[model samples]
Target: MTTYLPKDVTDGLHAARKQDMARKSRLRVEADGRSFAVLRRWQGGFAVDASVVPPLRGLVDLFEGSSPIASCLIIAAEAEDGEMHYEFKRATAMRHSAPLDFQKDDDAPVALIGQ
Candidate 1:
């Protein structure tokens, strides 16, 4: 499903782009090991315009091509303009190459200790 991001987030993304030195990279999203496209991306979060099989609730990985960039939590999901929109928060690197699983289970969700 398609998601719409907040104005401030979009504005920041655009502002970053206007700066010449910032790394301009679009991310590919993965939910529970399944690859998905990041239709829109920013520093804070991104959106995927496809159905989240069984629905996503926890971690979502952001990749730059094959390299893992960040792992975010799927904080909220809702219908926007006849599509499911997933909202994520800034990711935490729990461990290198961790599966970035989104399952809410006994295991603690990956988080960055000491901001």
Candidate 2:
């Protein structure tokens, strides 16, 4: 885990808690959770965090808009194996069918593709 001073930790938590749901970290919103930037927005349904931006922006078309955890590549869930696993809904911009729920699915994705 990353260690920080009491003030730093407190400030970080406060900032994270203030993030928006629109996936725009740079912009402030009234959402209840942290919103990563928009990596890309799909046609049918789905969106993901902008973590893979810059390096992968050219490869995947990260658009604007919010996609649910079920559709975006934001979080990863692991079963009872003590091993890391990604959510079934987790997929690249091209493979999403819906949006992932930000409330229930807050974990980030374990892996990125086409980088």
Candidate 3:
């Protein structure tokens, strides 16, 4: 199922972007020992600082069923209002042969992390 960003979340992400537009960068997302997604946002000090600060309750609660993941790259990040907007696409590491169910029209998902 395709999930949408909540209204509150959209606003927060926009605000975060405005607050630190320069810091956002691409991020590689991994879960259960597999690379599951990619997010070309949240790069520099902005992401770092946020990590150090208290986690947002709403942020933590958002995205039910979303795989818990560790990220590299900080990919993309935006903040608007009192929330954060994070956008990430899945990544296929080189180690895997081909992903099932995902059809390819001569285009393959790029591998973002070490296999």
Best by TM-score: 1
Steric clash count of candidate 3: 33
TM-score of each: 0.47, 0.19, 0.19
Clashes of each: 1, 12, 33
Model 2 residue runs over 4 Å out of place are 1-5, 9-18, 21-36, 39-57, 66-115
Sliding window of 10 residues with minimal summed lDDT for model 2: 52-61
| Per-model CA lDDT versus the true structure | 0.61, 0.35, 0.37
Q: What's the lDDT for residue 90 in model 2?
A: 39
Q: Is candidate 2 or candidate 3 better by lDDT?
A: 3
TM-score, cand. 1: 0.47
Query: How many residue pairs of model 2 clash at the backbone?
Result: 12
Q: Write the per-residue lDDT of candidate 1 for residues 1-115, one digit (tens) a residue.
A: 7699999998687555433222343556677778765655655555544343345678887787787777788765565532346666657754565575576778766886895
RMSD to the hidden true structure, all candidates = 14.8, 19.2, 16.4
lDDT of 3 by residue, 1-115 (tens): 8689899998788667644642342332333344222222343312223432333221111111243333322234565444344543432223224457866677766777876
- For model 3, give the RMSD to the true fold: 16.4
Per-residue lDDT tens digits of candidate 2, residues 1-115?
A: 9665698788676455434433343221112233335322344322333232221211122233443332233333332212222232434534455666655645867678885
Name the candidate, 1 or 3, with the larger lDDT value: 1
Q: After superposition, how far is residue 83 of candidate 3 from its true place, in Å?
A: 0.8
Model 1 stretches with alpha carbons more than 4 Å out: 1-26, 51-54, 93-115
> What value of lDDT does candidate 1 attain over all alpha carbons?
0.61
